[model samples]
Target chain A: MREFVPPSTRFVDLPDGFAMHRGGTLHGARIAYETLGRLNAARDNVILILTGLSADAHSASHADDPSPGWWEAMLGPGKPIDTNSWYVVCINSLGSCKGSTGPASVNPRTGERYRLDFPSLCIEDIADAAASTVHALGFERLACVIGTSMGGMSALSLLARHPGIARTHINVSGAVHALPFSIAFRSLQREAIRRDPHWNRGHYDAESYPRHGMLTARKLGMITYRSPREWEDRFGRARTERGLRTTDEPFAPDFEVESFLESHAHRFLRGFDPNSYLYLSYCMDQFDLGESCGSTTGEALSRMDLEKALVIGVETDILFPLRQQHDIAAGLSSGGTDVQFLPVDSPQGHDAFLSDPDRFGPPISKFLSVG
Target chain B: MREFVPPSTRFVDLPDGFAMHRGGTLHGARIAYETLGRLNAARDNVILILTGLSADAHSASHADDPSPGWWEAMLGPGKPIDTNSWYVVCINSLGSCKGSTGPASVNPRTGERYRLDFPSLCIEDIADAAASTVHALGFERLACVIGTSMGGMSALSLLARHPGIARTHINVSGAVHALPFSIAFRSLQREAIRRDPHWNRGHYDAESYPRHGMLTARKLGMITYRSPREWEDRFGRARTERGLRTTDEPFAPDFEVESFLESHAHRFLRGFDPNSYLYLSYCMDQFDLGESCGSTTGEALSRMDLEKALVIGVETDILFPLRQQHDIAAGLSSGGTDVQFLPVDSPQGHDAFLSDPDRFGPPISKFLSVG
Candidate 1:
């Protein structure tokens, strides 16, 4: 039950000129984070957990609040990550709405929020941020890195972008390349935000920032996060006398999906920013982990020491299809790395990583512990 | 390939007042329709294709245009239904947005659109509209009645509401009863409409309406009509970068699905009315074709005197799952009816009935033409 009794919080000053992997640069960027459990004497007992699209560093556990962390089930004391034995750290990635330096982060030079003026970023920059964050965390070398979905992507990007961050790296439900379909859906979400009329060309600050866009984004995200069969089985076109409490009346789905959207919207808005959503979704569209490589998948694997990395995929995950994991495993094994390819089955779809760790946790634990 | 060849004009007038299944009365209502194909000399060669959700009788091909109909590939001059042999007819149901007399229809008494004043309609009432429309066409008995999704529902309701219309039936991706989860989703869609400020209590009357509400409804419908796997595999976080013309932008989905939604929305808005969309959605939610005099599945099957029914369900048809089609087949089989269940493999979800008929048409053609 005790997920990571977080050690403490610290602030790190960005270099005088923080140039992006893209073109532009920023100055005086201060990043903040907290650590959990302890780094072993060898300092090899560290597992980095990167947050997803909208989540903060509070992935493990939180103090001053009884509510368990987002990944509470597996990261607790005596649990899989077993903070009692290993040091677990979660970082709020750059360009997020959380207390990190993002669109919401103040620009001391301009004294205004970054907004869209914030330099466009790719996952490589995110990997860089994580690398810098870890280095700032006083770790010389690491044991493993674990991330789910976007976070999984961040982990993969880190491994590809930064060398030797960990001996073994784990990426769950992520792919080496961004598929067109995913990029298309992300485009629609971004379009929804852009079309909000209220978006005011990305200058709409903290006060407004397109509520409709936020709602539409969450609704769209819900489409990707869960399985269609799950939604249909849970809430198909249901019957009602009064129809939609809206004007359409009783003709459409009063199905459970409405509730799912509403609940998801409410839970998300409390902790997210519109600009960050737009920026991150755009970044996802740009993700190409394979772009860093040689001619073939084999070359890509050869580029990375695959035997040291663990690849996890959710059977029902459509976003990052299991085929991609198989590809990764093939690449890793081709590269002469003993890749632990594990696909956990669940009806939860792309969300299985967060929902079911019974299968996901054990291998991660064994891989991290046995060695 | 002569498909739905609608008559110069098709019309049906209610001779007198009609009693309804939901204990209501409609004082002289008329239903309008369009027909494709030609009836045979025996008239028993009649095949009825029921319209789904807010559809009209324009199922197959147009009249003078003579292109293709709603079920274009399945019903043609020499196709499966073989306008050359069996007469294929589709009719607009009562309470629909087609030319039929619905809430939008002008009431003969006051010459005003029915609006909310229209009495609540049961599936039986909708079935009655189909029966009356078909009877007006001078058909004594139908060889078979085929339905997909909501149309399948109407076909079942017609069997119960009217006596001996068709001996053979195909309930494709539909159910006799509305499940609880189905009810819940419909409830949320209706709620979204009701909560929209512009609905103006359903009196939008074409001047203005809650376009946002209708948009939301369509968006939600988009979710149900398709699958997450398709979304993930096709458009997961993909986007089109700005100023992109030739190439399908970097962030946007080059996936076929993005085009699918765009086309779906375009067709939906042009071909359908917002108010009718709302009302029809509500009506479908109320449909429950479970049991009347049947104690068990056997009894329920016994209640249906179907000679043979081809229960076609798409593997990806989430709204009306394959399991439901199996249940229909199971119940019908128990009652001694010759039943065959076919699962159409597709990723299009419920829309497979209309969109991916290449896979659907062949099996259906074989099933009907076997005789």
Candidate 2:
């Protein structure tokens, strides 16, 4: 085991405009990343951590900014993705609002924000940017590449399209492509944001943001991200009686679940940009590792020459059902690749990957420990 | 069996202000209905068909208007709820905008559209208005009461709170109370409509309705109303080679599913009122048959005294899962009522009760024939 060290944030600039999958180009493309621990003298212990739709590069608390990262529970000394043994790097995806070259980023030619001017993005575009960041950091290969949800799809793309970037793969609650169910939900979210007159075709002023549309989109996302069981357990028909009944005040948040969504929506409205949200969510919908690789999702996974792979799925996940993870594992197994699939029983649903680190920590730590 | 006769549209005034469950009142409230076949001399052969949210009194074609209703697949001559035998009365519910006194109706006091000033509504209130319609029509008792989706909740309320209104009950994909999952979805839908600045707090002019917000809400609904399997089979990842791709035009409907939603949304916007939508959707979220019956869901259901019941649930319904229908059956059984719960295996999901009418017709027709 190696000693833990606080991660450092770094930015890598893609000097040339990055070409998008759908015949668009992103100029002055850059990715922000944070790395924990030190790379071994052999440079063989690097782990790339890809983020979901809204996460940044901050995977854990660092020395300068000791505030906990989103994945604070599972990335530290003696923790899964252990800083003690592996040099872990988490990169903010290309089209996100968080410290990345996105719609909010200024265009090189024009002095204004890219806004809708930013080229249309796809999951592979994000994966390509991550690959560039890894190469820029001077790493020949990685010990493993791990991702959850959108990040999981990105990792799959990296494994399928750009092989040998990582030795091992861990996909948590990720799909090979967007299922119709997810596509429908995401389509509605995008519609909600764009329909807001304030969105002004993604050209709204920063001060008077399209918060209402963003808030509604986030609420829809919050509903889909978690399982029905979780909501029932957490806030089943529970209401706060402090205010007049919701019957009288129909517009107010009545149920505890509504309040939960409202709180999350408010937080997201403050943190996320409307244009970046539309772009990234659309990218997620367009992601098809199978299409990127060759023919089918299974065929794509079968083509990956990984040392070992681990796939984690939750039972109650409606967004990315367990069958999707099973498909990935089966595809890899059929191709004679070493793979371990765990269908974890979790009521947390698609969000279990983030909320239930206990179920993930052991399997991840064990996989990293071997070889 | 009686000979089939086309129905006539009729409206009944409540005379005094109709009182709501939550203490709000709708003055000069009237219900619009269409009745088919002849009412037997005993006036006991009536099968009250409660319309779901967004549906009107037009459950079938009549002499005045030969156009098919929303449920055109069923409810014709020799069909389930057959005009050949049963005197079917389909009524537009109290809070709906279809010829009924609703938010769009002119207020007697202010001589303007009721809009938000319309009293807050609930399932029981809808049930109460339904009961009033039954009495006003001079039906000593109903042969059966049938409802689907939101109408299903109203039917449940009628059975549990206003007993003796019907001899038999058919509840399809309805719950005794709003689940947290559904409550969360409805909250987002309401937020989408209200947050639309064009909505102007439900005070928007009739010419320029909040169609965008309503469209988004309906799209969200369209996704939930059908199962993932149906979408995969119907639309898959199919994209048309129309104009430029979705990546080029982010705001446009590129996919077949999006197009389907857009087309349906446009139709709904043309026919429905935004304020009525808010009032009715909120009413659904507030529905709890148990509370109206002075107990828990199970307790309230157990308190019902019915001759018989047929509860239909689709295996793939995420909106109102089979478990909810099973609970309804179990509760009715606990009360010593003759209840037959049919878990119809269909890819249509929640809408299976409407879309898969062949399966429903057999069970429903058989039940009605026996009763």
Query: What TM-score would each prediction reach against the true structure?
Result: 0.86, 0.94
Query: C-alpha displacement of B330 in model 2, angstroms?
Result: 0.9
Q: Candidate 1 at residue A219, lDDT?
A: 66
Position A326, candidate 2: lDDT: 94
The sequence of per-residue lDDT tens digits that candidate 1 reaches over residues A1-371 is 01112334345655657777776776877555656677778887888887677766666664533356677778867787888887877877777766667877777888988877787777767777888878877885677788777887788778666667777777788777766545545656776666566777667755765776677667667667777556565565442345334533434334455656766876765357777787788787667666644355466555654338778887766567788888878777777777888877777778776766677778877877766
Query: What DockQ score does model 2 reach against the true complex?
Result: 0.65
| Per-prediction DockQ | 0.27, 0.65
Supply candidate 1's per-residue lDDT for A18: 70
Cα-lDDT of candidate 2? 0.82
Docking class of 2: medium
Query: Can you tell me the DockQ of model 1?
Result: 0.27
**After superposition, candidate 1 runs with Cα above 4 Å error:** A1-9, A62-67, A178-209, A228-257, A292-298, B1-9, B15-28, B108-111, B114-122, B138-140, B177-260, B291-301, B346-349
Model number with the top lDDT: 2
- Cα lDDT of model 2 by residue, A328-361, tens digit: 8888888667999999998898888788778888
